[model samples]
Target chain A: MSLLEKISDQATTLTPGERRLVENVIDSPTSAALGTAGELARAAGVHEATASRLAKKLGFVSYAAFRDALRDEFIATRETATRFEKTIAESTSDTILGELAREETQALGRIEEFITPEQISEAAQILMRARRIFVYGYGNAEVLALLMVKRFRRFGKDTHQLGTDPRGLAEQMLGLDSDDAVLSFAFRRPPRGYAALMETAKEVGARTVMIAGKSGALLTPRPDRLLAAPRSGDQDAFQTLTVPMTICNAIVIAAGLTAKEESLKKLDRLGQLIERFE
Target chain B: MSLLEKISDQATTLTPGERRLVENVIDSPTSAALGTAGELARAAGVHEATASRLAKKLGFVSYAAFRDALRDEFIATRETATRFEKTIAESTSDTILGELAREETQALGRIEEFITPEQISEAAQILMRARRIFVYGYGNAEVLALLMVKRFRRFGKDTHQLGTDPRGLAEQMLGLDSDDAVLSFAFRRPPRGYAALMETAKEVGARTVMIAGKSGALLTPRPDRLLAAPRSGDQDAFQTLTVPMTICNAIVIAAGLTAKEESLKKLDRLGQLIERFE
Candidate 1:
């Protein structure tokens, strides 16, 4: 069995501190794989001894052995080439499309299981109250950042997308203030500039919201509001954006609904402008 | 009962030609509402009289009356304001998130019912053979376009996103050749540069593929390959990106799987580059 499976198998017997460490390990495997036992305990807000106890509880010889196994498991499973090979080996060309669709559909169906209505409402409330919204995402996440900026702007919020380049990002960060909010998308591991952006937002007292994968729960300085869920597939498989995109839509809709009258008026004006121009 | 309901109810009695016209109307209500009977018939590749016959069969006094009702229904049901209002009226603030999630889940589940494995393979095959790929989307669709460009590039395809601006689009189109492919996303209606993009691709003999809503089935000078499905919710609700994003993911995976070895090599190189840079 995998390290995570072994950890979960012992869930009922773990002490509170041990349980906290176990949860942190599962939530951020990358950190668990890369960090020492003390760092893991500190990040999980637990006693250092809990990590070694949890390791023994899971039948490992020692804490170092447990860490070695975890690092090995992480590297073996998450290498992009290994993951892609597994995906290709599991399905022939004829079945790949159906398999992917099924995976994504199942993922979409599970959104409510991982994300709560309360979390969405909390994030939306922050978005509704912010004077301006700056979105941060990189790689595939950037597509979502652009999407959020466009949709939020349509709902009458002042919105901007932060560039991925460090220089441009620093320039943009200069404009943030207490009245603003930062909405970011992160999956798997946090992106470059994530720490700087979060620190700047904190420095300026801006409300911060993040839509991310489960790993987001372990972010050192967590956002003001977090809506985190697992993506559609195993950590090793190619994941789709369906789940996160649904969360984004829900957040936008919820925010718009929070101030119904004003949102509708903005949409009405948008419709008129489209009709006039197009 | 709604006009669409009436048409479906009479499905058993429709002639082949009448069925064609009904399908066209169901697929592209905007066209049915705004176009003349002859134009609608021609678009559906049916006899002009078939439009009138379908109208009469649906209990309308004349084709013009049918068109008028369709126009009214289309406008009343599809206006952004009306749709947003309906969404707002259907649920309390507490239930909106769950409701939207449910709607998107249902839509994602229905993807296989609308699209076929063969269609995905055909699109993927085109992508595999293309020397270059160009993606076009405007407004919200631009998000999907950006996503396709980024992912396809990762898989080692020469990919570019077609700008929404006419002058820039024309400049980009100048580079198209028979070795290239153009992929577009259109929902509700074709975007501003769609006609020119399609025409230019045709002139350059480039392969063309479109992922669109049902309305795309009737695009004049239709693309060489079309993968069309309905967005979540009715015609007017604030649609989420879940469905289209899922399709985009599937296409990307399918295309990569078509030439697995090369794609894996590219991904490995990407990983190494990331390891070196970080």
Candidate 2:
């Protein structure tokens, strides 16, 4: 049996200390295999002696033997990933298409970490009760802003979108007050006037939420709620927009869940309206 | 040993038809468990008798016993998923933050399938060799256009972003010709004049490439290259922007990789200019 299966079989019989080691190995076998027994034990919040003892209990002669088995498993998984790449690289169009679906599905799986049900619930609560909500995005972030506005409007929130023009922006900000909320997509290299826009929203006592890159946290006069989606790649190269967009989805979903009754009512009305128009 | 491990261990000994059945079961146990012997055989491109024989070889008394084991594995996976949801559902603020990082990482992984290395190389080659490049997007797409223009400019390409207004938009398209390329983000509910803008670009003999949703294929006067990124959610309830954004990243990365020397040279000059200004 594989070491993982052995650990699973022995799980119920393990002491609390040994259980911790098993969890560590199961969660990150690569790290466990690469490190010394002492290091793995320390990370798992157990003693070195306990770690060695657990290895024997799981049918390993020594901790080193256990680590070697883990190393083998880690190597096998990597080989599988590489084989998948090769299969796509040298294959027909069908495999190429399959590769795309695989990548997207994997992305959705990873996204669970970046956005949680709680964060969604919090953002939803803010949008739900706000007297007025202003959505702003310029450049690529603008699409995210437009989407938010459309979704919130369906839920019966009085939503507004800031235009691309700087000259008319101040006029739009005039009515924002303490009861209002501002959700802005202040992604990398935000427009020159964005800081001023945020400042004005803050001055009017509106709660300002910013969806931006890691650097956004250091900006002058920070926002009330900052959803930081860190850029992945060398600076000055291409940065992805998927992370921020997923957060947007989470917010919309959470809001719908939180205000199910009102949201459904509004959606029902919108559905009827669409049917009538058609 | 686990059923899956047993199959893997005996893989080399199995016939080709049995191997196909094993592969199908491994890839999607839920589906395989739910399917009948006939359906499983049809999917694996084998005889029904072969399917039952393979099950017995795997140590099952009958095909039903093999399916029972698969169903248990499928249920176990779901239980693990539920446990994960529980972990996050009851997690602290720190784990909530980690969720965002996980989701973004997954999205990047999935993006690999939608855009192949070859597609990136091809698109980059087109952008690099074109005499002139016009980047067009309005609403949220405008940001993508602006980003593309900025990246291309850093690589010393003559790139332009069309203004949002219709009158200025027409004037901007006047100088386009066969030697030019136009990259557009024609995402859902494209701005009022998007069709007209594409028509004019094509009329002026420029190649047009669009990054759009699946329905983008139905747009009037189809583009020369249409990179379709399907939406994740329901028809009207919060469509995601990550897929198209990832495609944009692929394009930029491909272009940068293709024009490595020129791109580096232009970036160096840009850095020096910034230093001088500061």
Candidate 3:
């Protein structure tokens, strides 16, 4: 099994000290690896011996091997920029290539840190079960939103991404029921209108999931379904950095995989309809 | 310098036979490595001796070393994929992840295979010196068009990307000139209204750049500048794969860096204006 799988498997059995050590090491490997054991443990809020012992528990011969495992995990996870703190630090750059690199790298980071296998499975079930799926993403998030529409529709989910009108979205939200769901991509704070729409969807008993940053109030209406992200913005820009979008992409994909066979059959029909339209 | 830089430097000086041999190897290492010299020569449409002589000339003791170096270059490029592709590939079960992965990977693959540094540099120069910039994208492409406005404006470029209404966009494009440039994006074939707007922008002598598929006449009112991408829809859904959007991100960033001094001053004014709005 992969080291991460082992970590997840062993997570429940671990003591609080072990859990904290593992989470800290996963999130901030470089700092703990480079620093002395005392300093690293102090920062990670564990005793020095716990830190050392945690390494052995994870199959390391010594603290160094633990650090090496952490390093390997780091290398593996770096493809998606799996840590929020690291992504924010890496966002700064002088050249366009530098900026593009940081943004793309952060996208990888957000995907690994945010997306979960359970979420994927659950979302797939929701999508497969839904009578209709309406996807909403406007401004810069449209590309991702549209991508989702394309994907969900492929599996025969009755999917569409039309939120050009705020009032229309609210009206549609009012009409939805538990058999329907809305997959939306909104970051930082979505337009004020979306909050009302989200509220209406919940009031009318729709399953609503969103990919957004930390703004607890916006999600108060349907807190259980919120897909929270590390908040990021450049003032006056309509587009958020792509790290969050990448996270959404991963979740959406996982959802497709775990969806029911019946949904796949429906998706086949929808695919045919689309071909007719073309 | 990196390996690509080294290979590119040598690329200019190599003869046609040598260059053909190098290009073929660089393009596909695994296939080239195992093939016999005669087979490889036929594959590259060259004489057998030419392949052997070219290999030896590059300082390879045997065909194996030359094959290994080319393989190394391909591996180096694939390393970028390693960070994200496996996880993405695994997520492709019945969920949205499969379509998203298939599309984005295809898009990025096209970009890696086709994008030129010259095109990137040219796009940067255009954005850097333009008297004014008008961004246009429609339907799907509108997401990116709106983003360029935010990103370019941050650097203080007087940029705009609102295309929901063709008349409004056309009216806005009225003031464009040769000194000004119209940055636009469209994939596949858009509505006639978009083409009409592009035509108007040209009639006004505005320079044009595009991120599109089908090339030239396939897209009307074609921009003087082109960032072309393959037109591959995912899951039979009429949704773009986002290759051009990614390229747009790169162009915006490169332009921002090249025009940093101006962008900085523009950002200061923008801050004050935004504060007033606040």
Q: For residues A28-133, write the lDDT of model 3, one tens digit per residue.
A: 4444543456766887798999888877776769887766554343322222222422111121122232334334433433443455646656765676678988
How high is the TM-score of chain A in model 1?
Answer: 0.60
Please report how far candidate 3 places residue B236 from its true position, in Å. 6.9
* DockQ values, each candidate: 0.11, 0.05, 0.05
Q: lDDT tens digits, residues A1-278, model 1?
A: 44544654565677778867866664445456556799999999987788888888889999988986765543221132234432332222123444554565555555666788788878888987899999999878998899889878877789999999999999999989999999998897888999999999999999999999868898867899888888766664466677788788778766766756343333323233323322
Candidate 3: tens digits of C-alpha lDDT, residues B63-165? 7666656544432232444443444444434434344434454345334323343455577678768888887766646656766776677667888765567
Count residue pairs with overlapping backbones in model 2. 17
Task: Show where candidate 3 strays beyond 4 Å.
Answer: A1-206, A213-224, A228-278, B1-95, B162-173, B214-222, B231-241, B262-278
Per-candidate local distance difference test: 0.72, 0.64, 0.57
Q: How far does residue B274 in candidate 3 sit from its true spot (Å)?
A: 16
Residue pairs clashing in model 1 are: none
Error of 2 at A226 (Å): 2.3
lDDT of residue A237 for candidate 1: 48
In order, the candidates keep a fraction of the true contacts of 0.29, 0.07, 0.09
The full ranking of all candidates by TM-score, starting with the best, is: 1, 2, 3
- Please provide, for model 2 over A200-252, each residue's C-alpha lDDT reduced to its tens digit, 9 standing for 90 to 100: 97787888777766445445556666655444332343344555766776576
lDDT of 2 by residue, B127-176 (tens): 88899998888765665676678667777889988887889988888898
